[model samples]
Target: MIDGALFVVVLVGALVCAVSAGALYAFSSFVMKGLTALPPAQGIAAMQAINRAAPGPAFMVAFLGGALLSAVIAVFTLVSWPGEGGPLLLVGCALYLFGMLGISAVAHFPRNDALDKVDPEAPASAAYWRDWAREWTRWNHIRTAAALAAATLFVLALVR
Candidate 1:
């Protein structure tokens, strides 16, 4: 019963959310494990390099665009109050916005900032890297789940 335009928006949002989830999943499932297995200095330096590279347009479009589209979809859904699909859309938007992006902002970025300040070769950096990588990967798992859940909800909304 959803309108065509809204359907398209939700579809695109789901795809973007899935992309973000996949990226996070990669980190959680293997990337972090691989990085952490490297010598601590190497791990720290590699993570720093990754953090530097992550903010570019390719990744930003998928991550940021998902949030942006979620907002748009949420607002539209609320204003229109379209049948059963409406609540699903709202919850999906909430998950993508708060669960995914919010966690990244509140949890990941601060850690990355702290990592940036560490001297990778220092003994202290090794200690910090151990904790940082563990904590960062844990939060990434949460983000991955959130994004994947949001994408699932988006699909459910479409089918409803």
Candidate 2:
């Protein structure tokens, strides 16, 4: 019974996280597009402003929410320890969690903390800000990709 419950939770959470991960990946692309459409200096300035603003909190809410849901699944998996693929799904969930944490601890949180020191409305160095934004976005892309991959593996586990 518990195994059944865990399987259900993992399946559902994986689906939700996968969708959200894809959405975030697309959003990054959208931001890039928006930047490209702008004049070079203006684009750099806008990206800088956005970076200083630490807009990731909103996304983190989603990421963390998904993670919490997955935690339930993880607990279930551990308790139940279903068939062969069950372990794989759990591994996927773990990877996803690590990726999310990596983004938060390594990339996003630091950027946000730094942003707290800087003025989003009036940046000190547009060049420095641009560099930071690019780096942050790059990490975000990696995070999102890993999350999606994890979600995919989890879904595959369901099929197996």
lDDT by candidate, in order shown: 0.93, 0.69
Q: Taking the tens digit of each residue's C-alpha lDDT, what string does model 2 give over 1-160?
A: 2247666776777777786687668757887667756655566556556656544776555677678877876776676675657677777777777886567688877875674455544555455556666777788787788788878877777777
Q: Estimate each model's TM-score.
A: 0.98, 0.75
The C-alpha local distance difference test score for the whole of candidate 1 amounts to 0.93
- Most lDDT-accurate candidate: 1
Task: Write one digit per residue (lDDT tens) for candidate 1, span 1-160.
Answer: 7767888999999999999999999999999999999999999999999999999999999999999999999998998885668888899999999999999999999999999999998878888888999999999999999999999999998887
Candidate 2 lowest-lDDT run of ten: 116-125
